[model samples]
Target: MPALGIDIGGSSIKLALIDHHAPITIAASDHYNQPSPDQLTAHLARAATRLPIPPDITAIGICLPGIMAPDGIRIERSVNLPALQGTNLPDLIAHVTTSPAPRRIFTDAHAAAFGYWSEHPLPDRLFALSLGTGVGACVLDNGQQLLVTARSSGHFGQIDVGPCDDPQPIGPDGGHNSLEAYIGLPALHARYGSALAGHLTTLTAADPPLRALVRALRIAHAIYRPQHIALLGGLGLQLAPHRDAIKAAVDEHLTCIADPAWSLHTAESSHHAAIGAARLASA
Candidate 1:
């Protein structure tokens, strides 16, 4: 059986057909921009039309960016995808896929962790931090997720790294001189005042985001003490090119704190999210 795994990102929507015979095998996949609420069902309909194979989609697994209703179907509020504020996810997906297939909705962060777990099971303890249009995280302990709710998890963006009298919020609600204000793309955009691609290519060692990320990493390491910490999401993956610099900076900053000695790996943002969803679809 094959399942449809969808990863709903603030900037992009990634979906794939997961082949059970091959486990994480993606039979077919598609990518698109995050659409508005009214356009979602149609977007799903169109994306569904392009599947490599036809309608035997056993179950649909979706990873959402924000809170879900208590019913677990309606998305209450998405910081990045505010358009999905009150959409009924399961019904919308069911209407388009036209199968009584069970749907599983997970926080994008949890999905990332689950997706990583699906691929790499050797490490039972994992902490996945996702930095994208919004910021949050998820943790796995002995294969069980630490945070599962409609609200939000690992609100890393809200962590206050202050100097400003009024900090802007990274989590979506309040505005504070929070970590998101320093590390988020919107913050970079604000600094440059343009929508240029690769504007962050020339980051410096003393850059605020670099400092903030190192600080966050140290705190997460001390708290979770996971065997591995994988970085996910658009900005997080973008840091791959600068791994050496980031690591060096982290080492320099951790003189007082004991080294946790965990390895850092980049999460296959789209692949892991989809694969994890597919695995959960079968569960």
Candidate 2:
């Protein structure tokens, strides 16, 4: 038996078959891009047909970028993908996965953190920042998600980190000079142009986005005191090569409560959320 893991993004859906025997192993995987709201079910069906999904799926884990209802069946809001608001995702997925097993829902950040923690379990408290289309963060305390607010496990991106030169704020929340306004994809593109990815190696504390990110990391240290802080997702993967520089910058204005040995890492898997969803469902 194996479980199905689906990670729905604003424009893409990533699927993975996680082996029940080996929770962390991905047996199969597929990616569908730019699916409109109406096309989601169709793409899911295509994934089911293309991937060799087992009939006896132990569970299914679905994660997305949103604030989930307490029951986890309905999405209350998704700033990056408003179309998903109030959508009954499990019902839509039921059309493709005709399983009687439980369907678990997870916030994308929580899934990424759990997935990263599953692979690296030593740190009892882990803080993970996901830098992608939008920024998100998750803190896991002894393998359980630590909810910072009533609606979200971690709303780290919405916090105002510093002022920006842009006339308008960059995130959907309309918060001025939020952390997302500094390092989010759209913000990065606006700041560095189309060749931004190519110029990541040249970024340092002098760069506005990197400087804001370091400030956010320092804030995380003061708040969570996490033993491990992981940087993951599209932008995070790109910044992996410059981990030392980023870490050094974060340490420059480090808080006294922050652990001197607190480590930073870039999650190796591109599909961390999907893998985490399936692994968590298996639990």
Candidate 3:
């Protein structure tokens, strides 16, 4: 039997149907430019109703942004998407799908981490940082479990970086000052003004600040001390120019710490959350 996986983001939603452990058969794929909560829920329900597969599929999984409680009752605040706060996602999706089999919901970062581990089969102490519009972090401690916390693991973009206090663009009341303010794409654009696009183009040509950014990420990983750090999302894929600098920085930082044995890798797919959700649903 096949399993259905849905990954819901602030900007887009992706769905896939996977049979056994083979390639995913995309039943329906659509991208919403900027979806409202009701619109997103309706879109997912419409897609789920028209799935071109057996009704008795193995399982169904949905991955969402923001922090989800283990009991699945409440969704904590979402930085990118404010409308999702306090939503009962599990019940909402259940109402939408109405399928008899078990349903699962996971944070997008958690799903991506699980998907990466499912493919790589890494050590117990592995973490994944997804650098997209924002930054998220997910960690697997024993390879069989997903850590749940009031503070979502992969929301590392919220971590305070240093003494660079600028008024937050999102809002003054909204909590903002974090590493994301420095490295997230939108924030980078805001800071660099018109030079942002050119900077990315130049990054492809080896920009110095971009290289320094990679080194900073490596330094953060060294402090975390995970056995492996997997960088995911679109920005991570474009880090090839600074790959050597990143590795060197990681090595240099680790040299001071006794018995440090961590390594870094970039994830191969943007659909990792969907893939992982499908795999978890089947499992």
- Among these predicted structures, which one has the highest lDDT? 2
lDDT per residue for candidate 3 within 1-283, as digits (tens), equals 8887787765556677788756676534365644677776777777666556566777888877666656666887666666577788765666346567777776677777787788799865777877666667787775554455553453465665433433433421244546566566656656678887566545521333343345445545655557777777656666645556566655654545423666778878777777788788888
The 0-to-1 C-alpha lDDT of every candidate, in the order given, reads 0.67, 0.78, 0.65
TM-score of model number 2: 0.88
lDDT of 3 at 186: 59
Q: Which segments of model 1 are wrong by more than 4 Å?
A: 23-35, 122-124, 148-153, 163-171, 193-196, 253-259
Model 3 clash pairs? 136-154, 137-154
lDDT of 1 by residue, 1-283 (tens): 8887777676655667777565344432233445677566566566556656347778888887778878877778777678778888866676446677778777777777777777777466777877776667778886678754443346766777653323433434565666677766566666655643555677655766766777777777666666767777767767777777776766664644444566777755556776777677777
Runs in model 2 deviating more than 4 A are: 22-35, 40-43, 69-72, 164-168
Tell me the tens digit of each residue's lDDT in model 2 across 1-283: 6888887765556677878455444422243443456676666566566566678988988888777777767878878767677888777687557788888887788888787787778557888998886889988888888887763566899888886454646566898889999888777877789789677878877778887888899999999998989998767788888899989988986888998999999878767888888888888
Clashes in candidate 1: how many? 7
What TM-score would candidate 3 get against the native?
0.76
Model 1 RMSD in Å is: 3.3
For each candidate in turn, the TM-score is 0.83, 0.88, 0.76
TM-score winner: 2
RMSD of each predicted structure: 3.3, 2.7, 4.2
Q: Is candidate 1 or candidate 2 better by lDDT?
A: 2
